[model samples]
Target: MDGEPRTNPDVPRVDDVETWTHSGLQAFLQALFFVLIVRPFVLLFLGLRIRDRGRIPAGRRPFILIANHSSHLDTACLLNLFPIRRLRHLRPVAAADYFERNPFVSKLTRTLFHILPIDRTARRKDASGQTGADPRQRMLAALQAGQSLILFPEGTRGNANEVTRFRSGIAWLAQAMPEVPIVPIYLANLGRALPKGHFVPIPLFVEVRVGEPLLPRGDREEIRAALESAVKKLKDTP
Candidate 1:
């Protein structure tokens, strides 16, 4: 069967804008699509470079993978970086409004990658316009269930691959689950390859730089700056 809703009967689907429940068929299709279609296309055309991948500790089921968000390629490149042994376990946290805006992208995203859709802005500011604190419980739940996540701490797309100030969620995740290491990834030239508001993608070389896994060594703001620094440093590196 195709993908269907799999969740506890009580936690409303609306709240699950950040949950990782997907279809077995879609996962299979995604592997086929990425391996046969996306992989060769990326490798032969826009090359991928993963710097110091060993820094990412092995055998960690539910660590956080945070990176800059310049284009959609940020997540796509990450899915390729993982080895076949751990590919199925990586979950890319996508925005609900963008990825699930329509039927086709929704289906593809859900099926191909085990995605956890999160409300980027709208739900956070409801009718009362009140802001809550660190509303990423679904992510925590996913981690509890042993699912590694590829998250964009920037929360939205940025310009020219510049690393933006991160949201507090990354810091929250690290603090909440100190055992899980937060991997900082630097994706170069993704904006040039397939940037925002572009349909036909250019065949440009892209690099994925993985840094040493970090914990919330400092407070939220300090940790956020450290993560950003890690990514920015890659811009000057080979």
Candidate 2:
């Protein structure tokens, strides 16, 4: 979700998102942030719940977890959905322009979440007419290093009431990293709490529904369709 959603229009737009910070201290700080900030934030507002957690394999095995994107809360909600065993290795894929646009946000997103940045401004092809390297390469490398990812393939926040068609980049990533499985997630009512404009969240009771993992199918369109269907199936889950 091409980069992070414009949670508020007042934030600045910056250049590329950097990944040069990963230290033990950063990891510790991330843990604290999750507990001190993220945990309380979600608990106080969202009636967040995860379903079908058993479908996801246990241990440190890396898998791409894709979810519907509506508000900035989607990121936080997804992060809290996993158990402690998997949360340590899960990284959110955010848009560079939104999060990296300011010094404060860049530090928070990079140091705490260790997010993978996608160049939202990139053209479809480079000057030579060949496709440029995907932003998900960083995500793929993270997976190779035993880290999992939370991705929103709609590439942008959609209306909370409906899901948009997913971009095919997810399929390519799945094909390239076939060793990792793909998990589909459905988020409901997140957008109503904080859609595109409002900075202060409205304290809505959001729901998180996790689906079973799907092995990467090489066909991009087919994979996208299946993922969409899977997410739709969980959209109305209790």
- CA RMSD of all predictions: 5.3, 6.0
The residue pairs that clash in candidate 2, if any, are: 2-155, 3-95, 4-95
Best by lDDT: 2
Alpha-carbon local distance difference test for all models? 0.73, 0.76
Regions of model 2 farther than 4 Å from truth: 1-21, 83-86, 123-133
lDDT of 2 by residue, 1-238 (tens): 3344335433222322233435668878888888888888898867676677677766778888899999988888888866543555777888877887887898888777877766665445344354433565656667777778889999999988988899877887888887788889898889999988889988778877778888957488888788888888888665
User: How well does each candidate superpose onto the true structure, as a TM-score?
Assistant: 0.84, 0.84
Question: What digit string (tens of lDDT, one per residue) describes model 1 on residues 1-238?
Answer: 0133223242224344444454566567777878887788778777777778777768856788888888877777888877654666787988876787777787677777767766665434643454321337767777877888889888888886477787878777777788888888788888888878987788888888888787767787787778778777876676
